[model samples]
Target: MSIEANLEKIERLTSKVWRSYSKEDPLGHLSFNEYDYLKAIQAARVPIRLTDLAKELEVTKPSATNMVKRLERKGLVLRVSCSEDARSKRVMLTEKARAPLESESEIYTIIAQKLKVHLSEQEFDALNTLLTKALR
Candidate 1:
């Protein structure tokens, strides 16, 4: 197949895989974007400034602010004045948010197992390596 044809095939399959998990309620309380932001906040290890979060997510400052507001309303995240610069605000995940974030790891493990069903061990490992490299 031509490269274009192969790429289109990969896109279609990727869409299908995303759809398989997109509508599920593994995270019943939070939308995917909210959960994603929470995951990012947790991974940061330190409270992150709103501007930095926007940069990390490649979103506008206003967009990131809106998302953080929504998360605050849901009690999943907290925004506090930056200690170093009191005028600026930082965002962090709450203890309550950790439970759902932990659940996501389990959910992904299940998803990974299902995805691997069609491939042999070698094929699965190769796919993992190739996709990781491509992402980088």
Candidate 2:
């Protein structure tokens, strides 16, 4: 298979694995986009303003607001009045959000471990560097 085909297959397989894990794990139902938002919110380690969240994700404010609304509906996040700016609201992860994010992290670590076990250290490092550069 071509490199692109292999990459696409890897993505699909990884997502399929995540879907299976989600089925067995009670908190794994979140969509990839939802997970992205949740991870970003969690990374802040404190309530984050919608604007800042949007900037962090490199998305528009409206896009961030819409995702937050969806997350709130899912009971994964909460929008509270910003103490420093009453006009703006900060988004915080709900208690319900924690388990799934942790599960996602575990899934990633498992996949990485599998890859590391298969590849030599130099090969894995090169792949990591290439992947990071490709993203940039």
How many clashing residue pairs, candidate 2? 0
Per-candidate total of colliding backbone pairs: 0, 0
lDDT of each: 0.81, 0.87
Q: How well does each candidate superpose onto the true structure, as a TM-score?
A: 0.71, 0.77
The list of candidate 1 runs beyond 4 A from truth reads 1-26
Query: For candidate 2, what is the lDDT?
Result: 0.87
Ten-residue region with minimum lDDT total, candidate 2: 20-29
- The superposed Cα distance between candidate 2 and the true structure at residue 134, in angstroms, equals 3.0
Q: Mind giving the per-residue lDDT tens digits that candidate 2 earns over 1-136?
A: 7999978977886887677666677555668788799989999999999999999999999999999999999899999999898899999988888776666777777667767897999999999999999998
Best by lDDT: 2
